[model samples]
Each structure stands twice: as structure tokens, then as C-alpha cells.
Target: MKKLKELFTQVKALNYTDGEDVSDLLWQLICYSPKMPVRLQSQQLLDEATSFTLEVDDSHFSHSVLKFNGFIWGNGKRKVLITHGWGSKAADFSDLITALRTIENLQIVAFDAPGNGSSEGELSNLLLFARATEVVIGTYGASDIMIGHSLGVMANIMAISETAIKPSLLINITPMVRLKENFTATMTFAEVPQAAQSKFFESFESLFKVPVSYFKLTDLYTEGAAVKHWLAYDPGDKVAPLEYLQEFLAMHPSVLSKEYAATGHERIIKDAGLINDIVELVKQGNKQGN
Candidate 1:
């Protein structure tokens, strides 16, 4: 307990850069220690505003569980499923959900991905993430528009390709084509020590607690085929490379792309005007469908 608290204090005191690689910090706190209480507290923090359940399914290669939080608007007829990025929880989409709630015809469903928040499973695999999404949408009666952020965008893309159920429209925020550039840049800019970098990956292996390979967005494009109107937003943020936006537009010419002037990756979700624009697009899509 003393060691855990000391570790937390050290992490909090570190003068971490804007894009500092905290994988080492996480490694010390989570993987190296058997601090169940600390892990539980972290999980609680991750799920602070999320209310959901664990619906487990064992039929798959490794047993997977879905963690879903739903908000019913009006008659609860129309539903939209929102997925968050790496290390994010269901509540991360609250701002978008609030904007969406203004439209009475829609309900919102959000979930924590495996190994991140209130979900079961210890690894973050694109295939498993996609499959979990399929299961959740199916369980929710297929009345949804899939909205995903970053990694979630790739997962949703894979989901559409793997599952029979399709969302009426797809909204991908700060989508990417590959993580090579972003990862390399982050590592270089953060100036993670060689020893720490090696330990960081080792920690990832231990912390994930499951077997799954990290996926490249190019892999999704190569193996995917889905036809749905796409609304993509990419700001000149450090987290997502500019090349990703360029490549995405090049590959999918039909995507409605918007580049925010000053907003970073996280701010895009909370931008009122941008959120309103997305809401309008969704409404337009619904009207066209009708």
C-alpha cells in the first residue's frame, strides 16, 4: 500500500510533457504491482460516470464481455452507439451524447472497451473489439448509428465488415490509417529512456492480460468493405498524424471531412459548433433514409 501510494505520488509529481509517454508510469502502477485496490480504484475512476453491465459470452475464442451504458430519449426507438479510443471509458462520450440528446428521436449507447474500463477481457485487439461491438449492437436490436473515435473508428470499420448488422451512418472522429508515425513521434518527442521504453512494452504484455496484436488502420482498409456515409474530423493535433487524414481522404473519397482550425483531438468531441454540425449531418442522413 505504501509503495502504491508512493508510485502514485511520483507519477503525479513528474513533469510530464504534453505527449509524454506514460507507459512506464502505468507499468509501475499496474503491471509490476499486485495492488488489487489500486487497480480497482483506477477502474472506478475510468467508469466514474458510466452505468453498465457485463454480459459475458464464452462461445468465442476467448470469452468476451460487453459493457454498455444507454440513455433513452423520448420513446427510445432510435439508438446511436458510441465507442471511445484507447484507454478511454464510456463516459468519455458524454459531451457528444449531451449534444445528441437534443435530438428527441435518438437514444445514446456508449461502452468501455475491453481492458480499459467497465468491460471484461484484458487485451485490446481490433478483432475482439469489433466482435464485442457487433454483439452489443445486436443485443440492442440493431437500432444504432455507429460513432467511433480513433481506435474505435478502426474497430467500427472492422465491425461493419465482420457483422451482418450495419449502422445507418458512421461518424469517425480523428480517424487514422496507421499508428506507426504517431507512435514513433510520441516516443521520440517524449524522450522515453531506452530502459523505460523496453520496460514499457514488457509492462504492456503483462497488463493486457490477454493475447491480441495491435492493429494498423491500413489492415482495416485492406480487409474491409462497408458502404455507409462517413463523417470524419481530423484536427491538426499532435496525437493524430496529418498523414492519417490525407491517406484516409485519398482512400475513401466519399468521406465528408472537416479539419478544425485550432481544436486538438480531445476538444473535437466537446466543440459545440462541430457537434451541432454532426447532429445536423445525422439528421440529414435520417431524412434521406426516410
Candidate 2:
């Protein structure tokens, strides 16, 4: 709990007016700080995981970069692309990558988004994320499964709409069509002060090293018009409202919707049962030629 509180404190203090400077600070703190227990925990997690090879690809979209880590599981005949959420690195889903490796003929690729992890670029909105995915799919020439978490899920939806790249299955973990609730919950969870919240755009600009106008959340939703087949997993939690999930389902009936009782937004990914269910769904979709 103390460590969680420290993380909350650090999140609350995130300055957005000068994002490049803030990014430098964040890098220094994450890479070298001894006081950050969360960083230590993350490092420990990474150290325990099986290492993969890093590959870099330039994005066709300006101000964007793609950095992916490939983990060849089994025969590597089938490929799966997994994307992480905001403020998360590609290695955050290492557990999932490791577990999926057990299945033969499956290859796993996890990419760090433009603003996060080792990827280069200033902060990017959902459109840029979609474009990055398009570039990855076009470069690889594969249409396997695509799994996304939180904001990454939103980007995936937009990407499918904007690009011809279609995967056999689209799995969204704790996705939200609108981000207002997510922002509210994040602020509450991080205990961000009202004053800080008022300066959110400015702070985000600084934190992401992007222009304030580029942080607009609505643009991402507009670009999400192309998603038809999808799976949405929403736990009864504060991060995303049931109404939001329902709205997404209503718009896309082909979406496989499930609700967990106790699993919150973050834990839903860690749930083995949920993962198995998703894997099964993908297999079913493949069998049905979906």
C-alpha cells in the first residue's frame, strides 16, 4: 500500500507544461531512481521474464515510431500483435506473452507505442497509433490476432477502420469508447489535485512532448468507425463504465462482451480464465473464418 501511495504521488506531480523536460525527468527517475519502488518492481518483473529481440521500424506517419519486441513461441506459424495501454511499456504484458508461447504455431509481437517505452516520437493520439499499426501490418503482411489494452484498444479499433489490415480476432481489454470516465477515474486514483487537473492539457503536452491540441481525445473516436468484429472485456469497475461497454456492444453486435464480478480494469488482463476464454474465442473465430 505504501508503494502504491508513492506511485500515486509521483503521478500526481507529473508536470505537463514542459513535456520534453518532464520526459527527461521521468527517464532519469525511472532508469536511475532508487526511491521509486514501482520502478524497482517493474525492473524485477522484466528481469524475471524471458528476453526477446528488439526491432525498430519507422512509421510512415510523421512524428511516429514503432519499436517491437518479438517472442517466437512454438512453431511461429501464426502471428499475434499485442499493444499496451497509455503509460505502459511493451514488457508490461510479458506474462501474457510467455503464456501464449506455449501454443504451437503462434508468434507474439509486442510494440511500445510512440510516447511510451523505447519508441521515439512526441506524444501521439489514437490516429497516430492506428497508423503505426497499419504500418506494422503492411510491413509484416500478416492478418493474425490483435489484442489491445485500454487506450491501445481504442487505437486498434481506429486502425482497423482507417487501414485495410484486418485480423482474425480483435480483443479489447477494459476498453472505453469515450475517455472522459477513464480520465476522471485516473485522476481520482492518482489523487491528482484539482489545480493539476485544470492544467491537464498543458501537463499532458509536456509529459508527452506533444502539442496541446494534439491531445484531443475526440479525434480518436471519430477514427474508430471501421471496427465491426470485436471482443470487449469489462470488469465492474470504476475505470470504465458499463454504459460505455454497452454502447460499444450496441454499435458492434459482433462484439463478444463479458463482465467479470470482482476483476477490475488492471487485473482482468492477469486473470488466467479470461486469457483462456479470449484464446478460445480467437480459435473459434479462426475456425469460422471471421
Candidate 3:
């Protein structure tokens, strides 16, 4: 982290120099997904699950084959898939995972996104993460529910939209909205030059084969869409603020929404009350399925 901060300093200076190509460095900076340490609480749940891997040809990485680590707990009725956001691993959802089990002896599947947690790849972007999600949903039946936090919400929605794989419910915890605005904020944090910003987007679009504008959350919403959404988020979340969600909320005012406070963005996924709501929603989904 210290080394990366030093590089950030260098990049900030380079951002001012005329005709300097900081795009490569900036690309690497943005793609670099830092892995968080697994908590002791999460470690116990992780140890109980059967560990597996899926070898994928990630086109975002020039069709490089990468092995992604996954975990599945329980062996009974119904299945639920849960995923964490950027810089987070499957184990981070330990508390929610435990509560979910109480709803049913559900075979819960969770995986670390490429370049995060125990997964392979040195760098990751939304395209790569969404691809991983689509692959996972393709392998496992998208039957009961798909639960996600932050960027995981984006990836989950992207996967379902691309594959047209319908889960019983889509539960978003601190869901991310407004991609272009968020990207601009990220560029500001990275100290990327306005000149280099355009270049970075060009490189991103080149690698992913789609402009950044192509990844809108609104794409998942349509008239008479069967899949339902249960959104739980704090209004003041700095990472994905209420402002970012305004457009989506305006478009679909009827989607099940829950407001939270003091939970912040990152830690809200593990909130006990939030988990209770998730369980309740899943219970309702199960009943509807039956």
C-alpha cells in the first residue's frame, strides 16, 4: 500500500507534464483491486465450506484463463448465491451467510471475483467481474436468489441482463448506481489528468469492447421484468451515495427499498438487522416459489 501511494505521487506529478503517457500507469492503478484481510469471524465460516475453482477464459484479459476460488456451504433445499463487492472476498459475508442458512439448509454459493480475495488474476475491472458472475450463474442454476453488495450488485445485474438468467430475487446491499459519475470521482482520487482521462476510457473500452457508457444499471430494469429487487442501503453512503441512485429510484419507484443509517457502505452488508431483512425477503421468495 505504501509503495502504491508513492506511485500515486509520481502519477500526480506526471499528470501535469505535456504529452506524457500516464494512461498505462493509470490503467494499472484503476485495475488494481486490493485484497482485504479475512476477519477471524469470517475465517471459521470459510473453513467449513467446500472450496472449489472455476477456470475461465476472461476475454477482458485477452482471453487469459484464470482460476477463481469459490465456497459452498450446506446441502439441502434451495440454493442462494451471494457475492461481495470490489476489494472484498466471499468470506466477508460471514454474518449474512450464517443468517441465510437459518432460512433453509440452503446450499449457498459464494466466490471471490478475479483479482480479489483467493481468486486468480493480478488486476480486475467491472467487465472481468461481470464475466465471472455470468460464468458462475451459468454453471449454477439461478433459481432462488442472487445477493450482492456494491460493485457485486453491478456485476450481478450485468450477468443477469447479459445471460437473461433469472433468479427468484435480486437483493442489493449498498447497490451502485450512476457509473459515469462514479468513474469521474475515481479519476479525481487517482489524480488522473483530464487529458489522460479520455485516454484511459479509450483503453478501457478497447480492452472490454464497450464504452464506459455501456454499463448502466438502468439496463436491468424493464417493463414486466420477472425478477424482483430488494434494495437495502444507507442514504449517506459515501461510496454509493443517495444522489447516485436518484435516477434509478425515479425510474422504478415501486421496487422494494429499505433505508439504513450509520451502517456506512462497506460494513452494511454484515449488519445484523440487514441480514434479518435479507432472510425475511428470502423466506418470502421461497414461499412464492413453492
| Reference-based lDDT, each prediction | 0.60, 0.58, 0.79
- Prediction 3 global C-alpha lDDT: 0.79
**Distance from true location, Cα of 133 in model 2, Å:** 2.1
What is the clash count of model 3? Answer: 0
Angstrom error at residue 80, model 2:
1.5
Off by over 4 Å in 1: 1-52, 56-75, 120-128, 189-214, 222-227
In order of appearance, the predictions have TM-scores of 0.67, 0.64, 0.92
Model 1, position 123: C-alpha lDDT score: 40
Top model number, lDDT = 3
lDDT (10s digit) by residue, model 1, range 1-290: 47656766765565655466776564454322211222444344334433545453533334545443333333456667887776565656656666676776776677766555545554444454566677677666674577888778887877776676556677788875565454444444445445555555565456455322344565565322434556556556667777767776777676667766677776677777778778887687667762
What lDDT tens digits, residue by residue, belong to model 3 across residues 169-234?
A: 778888877666677777788777677788878887887677887777766555334368778889
Which order, best to worst by lDDT?
3, 1, 2
lDDT of 1 at 241: 74
| lDDT, candidate 2, 1-290, per-residue tens | 35335655676687655432343333322222112123565455455544443433434234334454333334465668777776666566756766676555676666666545655544444544566666666655564788888777877766665665666666778875565455546566665556655466455556556643442233443423423345556557666677667765665565656766677776677777777777676566556655
